[model samples]
Target: MTQPVPTTPRPAGTRPPELEILIPAYNEEHRLPTTLRALGAHLSRLPLRTALRVIDNGSSDRTAEAVDRVAAEGVPVTVTGCAQRGKGAAVKRGVTTSPARWTGFCDADLPTPVTAVDHAVRLLLEGWPVVVGSRRCLGAQLPVRQPLHRRLGGAGFRLLTRRLSGRVTDTQCGLKFFRTSVARELFAGVSCTGFAFDVEAIARARTLGVKVVEFPVAWSDQPGSRFRAGRDGLRVAGELWHLHRARHGTQRPTP
Candidate 1:
């Protein structure tokens, strides 16, 4: 396990934040500035105390320095280091350390807009313990579509997720939220720490009877995605099979 290093200390006598958004980044120095600025601006307009944290997922770039720059601009952003090199690991560390009423993780590229945070927070305040941003759900707007091959791959992955975890149309949306206490408890038991981690996390949440709602959002396919269709896809499939067998005591379902 890796320990997180906080770049800035929280001021004394400050109220605990109502929400904390974690961005798990790997070599995202150039992208962090724009994403952090937009996120800070969006959060400022909402009527809630919010904080942002960037988990540096073993990036060899200036990702941490970029976060520090944002914090210096008085954005209330914090940078933390994660020795482990997986999105799920970084998110687990962030969720465990968060001291907010609600916590969630979003992709570094901001595929789902920062405004979706407000939407998710509203659902949480309305008694939804878990909220997910979905691009395939009703009312979703996709301004830019993913490549045809990628869309086909996503469809297959979604089918597998539905089989293992019931009725979740899109588990890999990269924007997920949870009540703080519930997030801590669930992440503590997480074992998958890669592309398929979302599937396992949602599956576990379902088994624990957590109420989850998916909200459709406006989305755009961002450039410089780290996911490699063939390599990462195979690894995710294997992990899904392992997760299914471990939980259900049966062979993995075919997508």
Candidate 2:
């Protein structure tokens, strides 16, 4: 399928001049063009300068080509090819390689509105350790098209995370910001390379005394999601147990 060509003007660098937005895209050729459009439309208006990096996690489709198109438009996009796949591994690569002091990761689908992203970055500037987007927080305006089981599963996962990690609510949101110095260390220590990577990041952050702040987000579901909840659910469950064991064992990394 011929994808729509990107129409937005290139975004100028922002004021703070050191923020990097790391987008982990896997097989998102169909969705990335629109996602980048929305993000570019909003970011082009912001005053903070940022470097945008798109890490292609071994996509078998046109994902790399699509991102290369954006890079050709002078969008400050860096596409790194990785043989190892998974969201966690992709995020780790993006975080560890960033030159900026502040780094963030957003889903390629960009389910949250771009304005909300501005808010999260603002919170980051306000002295938060890790500024995270939340769908369960009060005042959250979520997508109307989410399936019932997905919502229930999200709630269940957050509940388990609360008990297991003893952290704030909503650990699975795709949008999360970290200080570059902290992210460099955090991603280096992360072990899980799949869906439960978020939990592992949070656990390691808390263990390392990383201050965390949650920001309420306006989120909407996008189509063409690749996650299989049933299969991933079992994987996450096992990861949770393994994470706990690692936390208690001598294998845990020192903060």
Model 2, residue pairs in steric clash? 14-48, 14-49, 15-49
lDDT of 2 by residue, 205-248 (tens): 87787887888888788877878888877878888878877766
TM-score of each prediction: 0.93, 0.87
Instruction: Give Cα-based local distance difference scores for all models.
Output: 0.86, 0.77
Query: By TM-score, who's the top model here?
Result: 1
Name the runs in model 1 displaced over 4 angstroms.
Answer: 1-7, 250-255
Deviation in angstroms for 5 in model 2?
27
Cα lDDT tens digits, model 1, 135-194, are 878999999989999999988887776766677788888999999899887888888888
Poorly placed runs, candidate 2 (over 4 Å):
1-17, 249-255
lDDT, residue 249, candidate 1: 63
